[model samples]
Target chain A: DVKVTQSSRYLVKRTGEKVFLECVQDMDHENMFWYRQDPGLGLRLIYFSYDVKMKEKGDIPEGYSVSREKKERFSLILESASTNQTSMYLCASSLQGALDTQYFGPGTRLTVL
Target chain B: TQLLEQSPQFLSIQEGENLTVYCNSSSVFSSLQWYRQEPGEGPVLLVTVVTGGEVKKLKRLTFQFGDARKDSSLHITAAQPGDTGLYLCAGPSNTGKLIFGQGTTLQVKP
Candidate 1:
């Protein structure tokens, strides 16, 4: 089984605070992604990286940014946390070629106070 | 924008019953994927269908891609308690990103 590990299972933060979420994959996959899952909106893509230091915006990338300084680690940053940002965040990684299947981490549930 | 719409947002049936979930889209896709997610966990990919009109089976679960590449379906024969989860369908986006459906939540009672 492929393992994608997220640093935090649950998190809480105050409004206007800067928050960071970390993810690591052991499989050395070339593709990494960050997404926020909501009740009716499903999973909206925030950002994705194809390689280290390479990033692209997804459908909903207004308030988020991503970093991939290392091959195995990907980080998501929130410039300013707000109440509406409270949701489950997921991290996923995939192989480099031919759009291989993506493996996902457990997810981090964030609560902005 | 291209979109994948999943039908039957919620379903509950007996353990022995069978059910089918639909994933429909108006635009053609190069490939389609099905995933099952448990509460508080990320989605696990079940199958990926690339050929139009392709059919793949895994134990009691079956997946079929539409002939036009615009739709797909998942049919579970004789579901069990372990079949309970959120079913999601996704397709490749123009920028190599993935677009996921709203998902179908299934509950199988024993």
Candidate 2:
């Protein structure tokens, strides 16, 4: 089975504090993505990395950034956490092709206070 | 903007009942996928439909891709409590970016 793991299942952060969420996939996938899930807004992509050291901005990337130092690990960073950023953050990985199925991590529910 | 609209944002039904969920989009996609997410867990791929008109089945679940390649449907036959979860429909945009629908929350009662 394809396994994707997130650093934290839940987290609390204060305003202006930097937050980092980590993700690791064991499938040796070449593509990784970060998404935030909101109540009515659904899941919005924050950022995606196609390969090591290569990243692209998604539809909603204003407040978030991603790092892919290795093929197995991807990290999402919130420069300065705010209450508006409190949501469930998800990490997903897929093969190099567009049609490849994306495997997702359990998710990190962050609460920005 | 490319968007997928899923109908019946919420569903509640008794065990042994059947249900169908729809996902429609004005934009075309190369492929459409269905996922099921349980509480506190990430979404899991249920099926992927590539052809404009295609049908795939997984046990008690059936999936169909619209002939126009802009829509899809998921039907569950004799839903069990284990089938309760959030159902999501997603498609790839022209740039190969994944676009997701709002999702449907299904609750099957025993």
Candidate 1 lDDT, B1-110, residue by residue in tens: 88999999999999999999999999999999999998778999999999999999999999999999999999999999999999999998776678999999999999
> How far is B110's C-alpha from truth in model 2 (Å)?
1.2
Worst 10 residues of 1 chain B by lDDT: B90-99
Which window of 10 residues has the lowest lDDT sum in candidate 1 chain A? A94-103
Candidate 2, residues B1-110: lDDT per residue as tens digits?
89999988999999999999999999888889999999999999999999998999999999999999999999999999999999999988877788899999999999
lDDT per residue for candidate 2 within A13-77, as digits (tens), equals 99999999999999999999999998656688899998999999999999888899999999999
Task: List candidate 1 stretches off by more than 4 Å.
Answer: none
TM-scores of the candidates, chain A only: 0.95, 0.96
- What lDDT does candidate 2 reach at residue A89? 95
Can you tell me the CAPRI class of model 2? medium
Query: Candidate 2, TM-score vs. the true structure?
Result: 0.97
